[model samples]
Target: MWREPWPSSNRMPFTKKRKLQLSPEQCSDFYADQYGKFFFPSLTAFMSSGPIIALTLARNNAIAHWKSIIGPVNSTKARETHPECLRAKYGTSDLKNALHGSESFHAAEREIKFMFPNSVIEPFPSREGIEEYLSRYVNPTLLHGLTELCKHKPHNPCVWLADWLMKNSPNKPKICDGVTVEEAE
Candidate 1:
């Protein structure tokens, strides 16, 4: 299923651009599993012929939305049906379609991995999960800190609260080996 990024947008939310020229062998390897044996060679040659821009688009239903904007695979068909589309406006034929979009979420993930090996794709957290995390780890500690701050009414409340939280935190590391200053009698 298509996974939308957190904080939904009406438009494309994120774009990462990579400019690279692929060798024919690299192109062949890239499309090996996607295209058939007969179609692979030409597709590889065309892809490797010049420099290409690889873009990663992130938003709600990005793949489907982009595909719609680019129009059909055949430029001639796109011209007839969707004259405003990128392929219709720029492409000359089916194989020479002006742009390519991932067919599905799986294809998108696969293509992204192939194109950007170093990149990390993270799944968005569910709303319930986020709420649960806050409730379990944050609310109690924050409540205590806020209550103490209100009671003490420190001159620099923000700093005071921060220091108080740090000092009172169960997660704070203990320094057992540190020298203690003895009180003067």
Candidate 2:
């Protein structure tokens, strides 16, 4: 009864037959546009696999946090361990990790564009909404990494540390004594 409705969904199985294939935009527009061909001809074929929920998580190190949250991309390894991870919990194979995130900000921008062209995918922290900032806040070091990423540069631990400080400084966040996989390790 726990895994209702979504069992055997395409998302549960990351197979060649189930992958979504989005095409690149073709060139030569103006009355009759003719250039690009469909990249994944069968993306439409798998429409009813399941309903996917899209989440926009706000954290100092959003991408990295998400990567960690989802854990590694492998599934068999996920099964034996990483049970707390999204992949470890539900991923049937190497592909279905139950979530997705932008590898980079540029990619995030492009992907947001592709998925929701007119939809507003705002940066963390609304300019005017004070309460929202608490929920959508980012720490300095994490922001720095995102800045470096925008410039196409590699990240440094110092930047990551800065983000860590930003995330924990204001709240003086509690350190859990409750057992967790990371804590057990």
Best by lDDT: 1
**TM-score quality measure for candidate 1:** 0.64
On the 0 to 100 scale, the lDDT of residue 93 in model 2 is 57
lDDT of 2 by residue, 1-185 (tens): 01113334323212111223232221111101222445222222222244444334455666787677667668678667677776777766554445555677766566555544465666665556755564455444356556655675436756755665655554454456763223220
Return the clash pairs for model 1, or none.
none
What value does the lDDT take at residue 119 in candidate 1?
Answer: 81
Candidate 1 structure quality by residue, lDDT tens digits, 1-185 = 11112223323444676778888988877777856767677788888888877778887778888888779989999999999877787777777786788877888888888888888988767889989978876787899899999999999998999899888664555455695444332
Task: Candidate 2: list runs displaced more than 4 Å.
Answer: 1-48, 121-185
Q: Could you tell me the lDDT of residue 44 within candidate 1? A: 81
Q: Compute the lDDT of residue 162 as modeled in candidate 2.
A: 64
Q: What is the lDDT of candidate 2?
A: 0.48
Candidate 2 is scored at a TM of 0.41
Error of 2 at 95 (Å): 2.8
